[model samples]
Target chain A: MSTQLTTLLAVFLFPGGLFALVLGLSLKGLDRRVAARLQGRIGPPLAQPFFDLVKLGFKRTMVPATASQPVFLGAPLVGVVSMLVAVALVPVSGLYSPDPMLGNLIVLLYLLMVPAIVLMIAGSASTSPYGALGFSREMTLMLAYEAPIVLAVLAVALRTGMGQGGVITFSLTDIIAYQRSHGMFLLDPVMWPALAAFALFFPANLGIIPFDIPEAETEVLEGPLLEYSGPALGLFKVMSALKAVVVLSLGIALFMPLPFDGIWGLVGWLVQLAVLMEIGVTVVRLSMGRMRIDQAFGFFLKWPLLLAIASVVTVTIVA
Target chain B: MTDHTVACSYKIPVGPLHVALEEPMYFRVAVKGETIETVELNAGHVHRGVEYLATKRTLLQNMILTERICSLCSNSHPEALAMAAETIGAVEVPERAQYLRVIAGEVKRVASHLFNVGILAHLVGYEALFMHAMQVREVAQDLKEAVYGNRMDLGAHCLGGTRCDMDDEAITYMRSALDKLEPDVRELEKTYRTNGSILRRTRGIGILSHADAIACGVVGPVARASGIQYDVRTAAPYHVYDRLPVNVPVLDGCDVWSRAMIRLSEAVNSIEILRVCLDQLPEGPINDGGDPYIPPGQAIARTEAPRGELVYYLKTNDNPEPERLKWRVPSYPNWDALTFMLKEAKVADIAIIVNSIDPCISCTER
Candidate 1:
């Protein structure tokens, strides 16, 4: 196949479009089921997310009269597209790797930001009070978490780049390859702070219970998505599922992608992803309550920011 | 409407129908960047004209009508209405009937308070704790269903005394249910008291000062949470509450957490009260045999409901129906306190603060 055809196939077929959507929706279903079990209730089935998507598809997409029609309708499409491409960008260890020319870690970071940006745009464009409130909240959360993530990514880049006789490298493949050759970065004490920083970023970026202030169902009635219904809402769901796979897979690729190739690599990757989802998402959401926006803002600034800075400073010294 | 400054560009209407509120009470909140500058509460969506309905219905019929006024505080309405009518008619409630009334009130108190705290957890996004609290409340609900034959609207009170009489088997079932409820409630209380997520959201979020609490004349847990020592069961000494070991827990925190803790303590206290009611239940008649005649007169009676002090006034005429029937629910006073609580409060805290009052729209509007 030509390079462009292979890239298209990669984006639309394998690790990106259809496969990531299925994987992401199933993970969400599992998260809900496990959360229900943890709370001592019979939760929905594993196919519940898919069922919800189908239900959403059958319903009409109602747009508010006051909302900016194009912007409001367009945001979810942009979000879904970005996530599909992002899933392709993230190489799943030995099972598949993307063509480096498609873009690198820097491009992936920008794509990773599209969902939050889409939310902000969707919120603002909807012209509802709660949506505007959500826009500001998403903006604030993005600002708060953005700093640590940049520093953490830079820390990893520095650690890997210096190992390969370069000052810096924006390539995720090189980082994965470097980690593969010299053992996993997760085991190294130098990368632990960045890992911790990344760990904290997950809940906020994913908009889970503690940092879900922007879209608190009780307070804002889903904030940005309050005015959204039908297929538009389903698109947001699709974006999230793809984003979860991308983010969790990004976490693995960044710190702890196992060194097994072929089917074993895919199995190890699946197990690791499930473990991360179960421990990181389900258990944490079940255990903790939501934080007020100001408190969450302060928490990200004080702890994650400090940890990221420490990781960068240490990576500079150690590498 | 005592005082609040509304200074913001956009006014948000948080409904007669919203996710946070159990009942329909619209709040017109003005915000200055996610911080609420003022809140204008518009009530009466649940205005079923129960007060007017009460006057039209016969005294015997009003017992059933009044219970439908509010689901959570259902027992209190008829209990207070019955007390006022009994006082007006110069009818003394039988000793066994009074004990049964205490048992009914205490059981409703436990269920209602658990519900309020459970919702608080839900608003904080701690759904696990919310579900667990609800599961604990389910035990109380089962106790109500087994003993009173309804999950809500327990029609236990009559004009002269109690309508529902518990047999020995029902009493034994209640003891075991109460046993299952107590430890679960204790564990829930500990979580709310110490859990980081709950504390972070609620500890000092909604400040209803002790001075503000007194000025608002807030009753029930809202009053007790703000350090005001008032419980109608203890202060007014109605219906064997004086004889029973009723301890009112007071806190000076004057916040959402304090309100929740106050409710939990009351729920715990209610279990003890229920136990005592069962143990010392007299073996005489449960009522005056049948509905006693209520002669022409006027009287007022107060009772400490699960929320706070619930007041009812009654005036009887020659007709079968009363000439007038009115009430002052605890939520009425506690509702105004939200204006103070929402002042400069973060928008996210609005629902939590509103819920902290445990405001019942049905009773307030009726």
Candidate 2:
């Protein structure tokens, strides 16, 4: 009974539900403000995204007559639930470690894929032409980015598993422990390629510019979300916010987690996430334009794929 | 093994309310997989009967009416109509007024071109570049407000000459504004020229060849970008342009990148022209301000608008209102060329190609 209560508290209160949602929304708000400053304009208030979400909740969720009602309503809920579970799985260094029974790195990887898959399903179910175009583009981009991400995960798993005298370990606690004692893979030159590949995956997963082809607001009018209104749309926004925290935290745990303990460690972790969001997501997106789906596909196949493979080979030889 | 069937083609309709377009123009793009098979364009969504209204209004009233045709090239319409009316009445425009007209026209060109390029960046998915481009354009907007007393529609031109004239303070302000705008534009030019990602998206994406450009009657930077050296300012110099030397930037790359580069280079050239006009500005009355009279004659006047050559034909018969008023805007010729440029292009390249032509729907539909 006590264990059940702890699990509930961990999932809902501390790191997963409300906590991740707030942190994610705040980071998004900060990104918008900084981007506006870079462009010489005064941006929205930092809490504007929260206001937008609340406003969206009061509006009607009008489902198109052509759309599949069950799938259209269910997609955002599934996405939000998957991300909530994923967030609970990410360890906050010395502050907290997720219960091993709940999940691991592999489970988190599967959970990370839910949002994109949900978008594709929603796009198809919406029955709009833009939604269909978005569905095709989303599928193409997923096929392109998924390979590099898998190889990047493999590189990290091998680096951690070999360090601990095992063939492989899908455990997040083990990976973090190995990095804490032996120093972060971020500092290791052999793991640099995996880090580079992960950097490429970061913006693509978050739907920032350049890799934001799936939901190109200009091209397809927000594509899959065109038909989604009110609470359903707000759910999509919530899912994305939670996913940002999960993905950013996952990247931290895999690569450059600080070795501090207690509250200091958690604060350090948040600082790392903020810096990554600014540099990796905000500044880079502001500087460049979006590439075509084919251009992006070709780019992934050439650069990130090569880097991911090189990282795996170097880790196999070094470890 | 002998099954015979025809592959179905998909029709993707992009907006009367689409995200990529600023004005409402519908496009029924036929595609086989991701490649564009054929494109059918439908315009006239923002059509107002300005020409019909012109028939009812007097010549002076029509000057103001013509300005309302399109805000981007608002001054060009009135200037062209004024020149046509001046030709019929045999009115001599003051030397200083001609210089002032050139200044107003060139300033409008810089702002309009910057806006088009900024939209191109937004469509390309380079949000930072787009914002930076617009920020740079704000300097021109400030210059317009300081000199012409308005940001968008300057309302500078009148029947004989210009309605506004620059004082020493305004000239100094204009000079200083150009000084600040030049280096920022150069830096943006460097970014557009060298950025690898931008190059990947723009270069060779929307090829409008030299022959195709001429065949389609393309004008302005769209034609110049395709290696056609046809600019009305140089081809048939108007106002003070004959006295002021101009160099038109021509590129043979004939794609979206070339079109963008042409606009950037032209904007820089416009600054140079503005500098020369200010330096050679004569000392005299800005306008004739005589009794406005219309003779029984027909005359046509052409001016190099920001987009291209804008031609206005005016006919009068000893009456306050004209008999007929007609105009040939640049967007009219360029709209037909989209079909050729968009052929064999990807769905993602649709917006980029459409923007490359810089089609002004209001100007076209009008």
Candidate 3:
């Protein structure tokens, strides 16, 4: 209701959402550029993603005969909107988000899950066998990565609370405020392990490799995205890119809180945030190969899950 | 969630057309409880009758045709065809030509391996690795262009010798390029070996034992990954390989990961071989052999391609064109092994594992 909240919401919705969408695509382009250099060939242009989106956007979209229309139609829209909501919740270049409470740790986590759910619903709606196969794989991936992600969130929450003289706070603003008073990077050293856990989670949560089994190109053909075309696929891609921004931003927000507290101080904070996200993604991706769905699941069940559990314990201990 | 739905098993199909690998293939998988019961591969979608088309094209023309088989394994086809032609012609190519051939071939091997590494990254959704791999490969491309004047089809080989000559400037360029690549390839190899995600995904999945590889008739990296020490370069001694000291990496795992590792190791080895060839290269004419002949009898020649052993069978009838040419590319044997590789691997590995063979579907179908 306040003008500040309204302004913050506007910034998050347009710039934050757009920044993520564009940044994610740019990440893909940068990936191509890096790959080209490695192969000893000059690869496609850095704006290749922009061109691809334009091409896919103009392509035809035909629903399969066996598809369920509502789920099919609603899935991509929901994917985009949910990502938009996540963007809305995360403070990008500002002090707080619009309806800042929605930026509560739990709500942000739930919003992150919505895109995957919508993807499954849409994938199932297509009724294509590949779609079904991809959807199932996506579900497995969802289960695999979710625990680590939740634990990552819990680690940040507990670290913030423990560092703030034993006050437990779930609010992003509160976490930021705590960090503003007491430097964020100086939270519980146990939070270092938790941060490490989150670092791993960022890739899986965004479905990047070594954890991208569900959408393995050879096996699933974009997984839940096999049947999507034209604007629908475009929207899905945009949402994915935005989701990258959101997840990375969320990671940045949790551990590397802003040095500046005021809204005007956000420019420097956002730049630092972008660089951190880029470096994190670049390092992890370059260093790892992809995991098979089963292997990925096995991994989640073993180490990442343990890490997550450890974080929760760390939260309890630190809190 | 229904018992009835769970009780009855159904068939699901995925792609003869999709964006996993650049090539398209179909699969009909039967799943009974989220576990795949059976997987049936449907190839031939991308088959453009390359073999049948080979029957129509002349031997010299087919060199270009063969290079088009796959973007990654671009140099293997021309090398095989040229070797086959040499066997039929009974011509001993100049030593310098032999050295040049080996250098060019090894350069391509490094480039091809890097490309496969990128695809492996792409498959696992490791965009960063994919990009880095490709970036490193570009140095090889530059060398290719500098040496042969074309990145993809170097147009180097005729029957007895190559079309392009490597001058001092080109040699200098190659030296500098390898210097840049040495560190990059090492770092990339380390990442593959140590990264938990990649190591987890590739280490044990799609394991093909030594027996399975021999039974399936796998060749090249696929066979080597299963601990087979059969490299055509060392075993058969093609070109200058008999003269040069080459170490073929043999991993005993026989799994998808091993195959990937073998390629990485080979890339480094190829770089070493190139440096040796460069140091020892004798100064002579690139192509001093007389004009190529269309022999009356058939001749079989084999070379160690980047993938593995590539066998070329040529039947010339004393005409400008060859009567018949049959190429036993590494992929023909490797593709047969795919049935075994994919049998146990979770479906997600199909792309990378298929890519690990560097499956030149164009070469296979051709």
Candidate 4:
């Protein structure tokens, strides 16, 4: 009973619901501020995203007459809920490990795909032309990026499992433990391909500039999210913010879970998140242009796919 | 057609309120599964009847009214209109005024070209490149504001001369600003030329072949990108362009990248022209300030606006107010060519192709 209570506390409080939400929003805020500064303009306040959320809450949620009322209202909720659980699944090095009963890396992988699926469903349900266009692009992009991500995860799982005298392990705890004792996969030359593949995966998964073809605001009018308004839109924002935490934390666990313990580990993890967000999300998005759905599809199939496959092969032979 | 056949194709209406466009122009796109088959455009959402309004105002008032037609090419309208009025009235603009007009026009071209390219980066999803381009463009913006007291519409051109004159300090400021902008623009040119991602998104995406461009009567960067060597500055030398050595950058790639490259190269040329104008600026009165009356006559004046050739026609009957005022903006010629560019484009390329022409719906509609 106490374990159940602790699990509930973990899901709703630290490292999950509230904490991840705040951290994610703050990171997004920082990204905007830094992007503005780089552009030589005064950006919004650090709390601007949060204020936007509060302001969104006060506005009315207008449903398009043609939209499927249930899916239109329910998509963001499902997305937000999925991300909340996914955040809890991400083990924070020495500071916190997800309850094994909650899930593992495999479950987290499926959970991570929920938001994109939700976006697709929301778009289709909206019945708007742009939303329909977004749905098609989102599906194509998902098909493109998913292969590399699965391969990248498999590469890491194989590396950890092989070192521990097994064929494979999907447990996040085992992956972190292997990295902690044997030094980070980030520093290992053989794991560099997997690391690179993983690095490519997050920006696409997070829908940053280059791979943001599905939600290309200028093209399809933000595609699926065009029809959403008020709290429904805010919920999508929450889902994305929480998603950034889950995906970033998952990357750290897979490649470079820090060796520190307790409070220090948590602080170190936060610092790492900030650095990764800055370099991967902020800087990459700032510099690059968005590729068309076909171009992005071809890109993923070419480079990251090859890299992920190479990483898997290298891990198998090396281990 | 059978019901099954009808089911295969669907029409998607983009914009009357779409995010991709800055102004309201609806495009009814027929698609057969993500590939655009046909595009039908419906414009005039931003029409303010500026041509009709111009006839209501006096020659002086029409100069200001024409400037309001399109903010991006705001100065071009007034400058062209002023030239038309001057030609009809047989007014000889002072040598210094001619140089100053070139300076204003070139500076505006630089800012306008930079803005179009920056927006291209934005449409392509290169936020950093877009921001950097805009930041570089701010240098030109500052120069305009400092010289003409307005960032967008300089309001400097008049029938006989210019309303604003550049002092030595302003000239020095313009030189320094150009100095600061040159390296950054050069770096941007390199990035656009070499960046694989940008190349993939832009190259071969929206091809407006040289033949198609010529047949459609496309102008400015769109024509230049398609290997058309026609530039109003060189072809029909207006004002001090005869004194200046105008090198028009023509590319045969005829794609979005070529369009972008043309704008960048043209920006560099505009900077050089500005330097020459500053050096050759003669000492004289800025304007005649003679009789405000324009005798009964009709005259046409054309200048190379940032987008393309801007033509203004003026007719007067020995009165303060003109009988008729008309303009032929570059975007008008280029709008019809979108059908050719978007013929076989993917749905994703729709916005990029539309923006590639840098279509000014306001100017076109006006």
lDDT of 3: 0.75
Report the C-alpha lDDT of model 3 over A1-319, residue by residue, as the tens digit: 8766664555454545665677678866776676556444588898898898999888988787888877797788888877877776765434654455445778889999988888788878988666777777788888887888787777777777777766566788767676667776436476766777777777777776666655656567766787788888888888787787688778767877666656655666656655755566655555566666666678777887788788778777755
Go through the candidates in order and give each one's DockQ. 0.90, 0.74, 0.48, 0.77
> Which one wins by TM-score: 3 or 4?
4
Task: Output the better candidate (1/4) by lDDT.
Answer: 1
The stretch of ten residues in a row with the least summed lDDT in candidate 3 chain B is B1-10
lDDT winner, 2 or 4:
4
TM, every model = 0.97, 0.97, 0.81, 0.96
Which lDDT tens digits does candidate 2 get at residues A100-134? 88888888998998999999999989988778888
**Ten-residue stretch with the least lDDT total in model 4 chain B:** B1-10
| B1-366: candidate 3 lDDT, tens digit per residue | 656554444666645655665666576767653455677877787777776677688777888788787766667778788878777777778889889888878888898888887787777666656777888888899989888888877777766788788888988989999999999999999988887767766777677879988898888888999988999889988888988878988999877778888999999999999999989999888775556665677888888888888888878785666777778878788877777776745556656666777777666665
Best by the lDDT measure: 1
**Model 2 chain B: worst 10 consecutive residues (lDDT sum):** B2-11
Query: What would the per-residue lDDT of candidate 2 be over residues B1-366, giving only the tens digit for each residue?
Result: 976785466788987777888877889998876788989988878888777778889988988888888888988999999999999989999999999999999999999999988888899888878888899999999999999889988999888989998999999999999999999888888988998777988999888888999999999999999999999999988898987858899999999999999999999999999999999999998888764577889999998888888899988887788888999999888878888898899888888888887877887777
Q: If both were scored by DockQ, which would come out higher, candidate 2 or candidate 3?
A: 2
lDDT of 1 by residue, B1-366 (tens): 666775356789998899998888899998889888778978768777788888899988988888888899999999998999899888999899999999999989999989999999899999998998899999988888898888998889987889889998998898999898989989888988898888888988789999898888899899998999998888889988879999989999999999999999998998898898889998988887878998999999998888888899999899999999999999999999999999999889888999999999888998
> All candidates' lDDT scores?
0.91, 0.89, 0.75, 0.90
Give residue B153's lDDT in candidate 1 (0 to 100).
Answer: 81
Error of 2 at B359 (Å): 1.6
Runs off by more than 4 Å, candidate 1 = B1-8
Model 4, A252-294: lDDT tens per residue? 9999999999999989999999999999988898877888787
Q: Could you tell me which residue pairs clash in candidate 2? A: A288-B126, A289-B125, A289-B126, A290-B125
Residue B25 in model 3: lDDT: 58
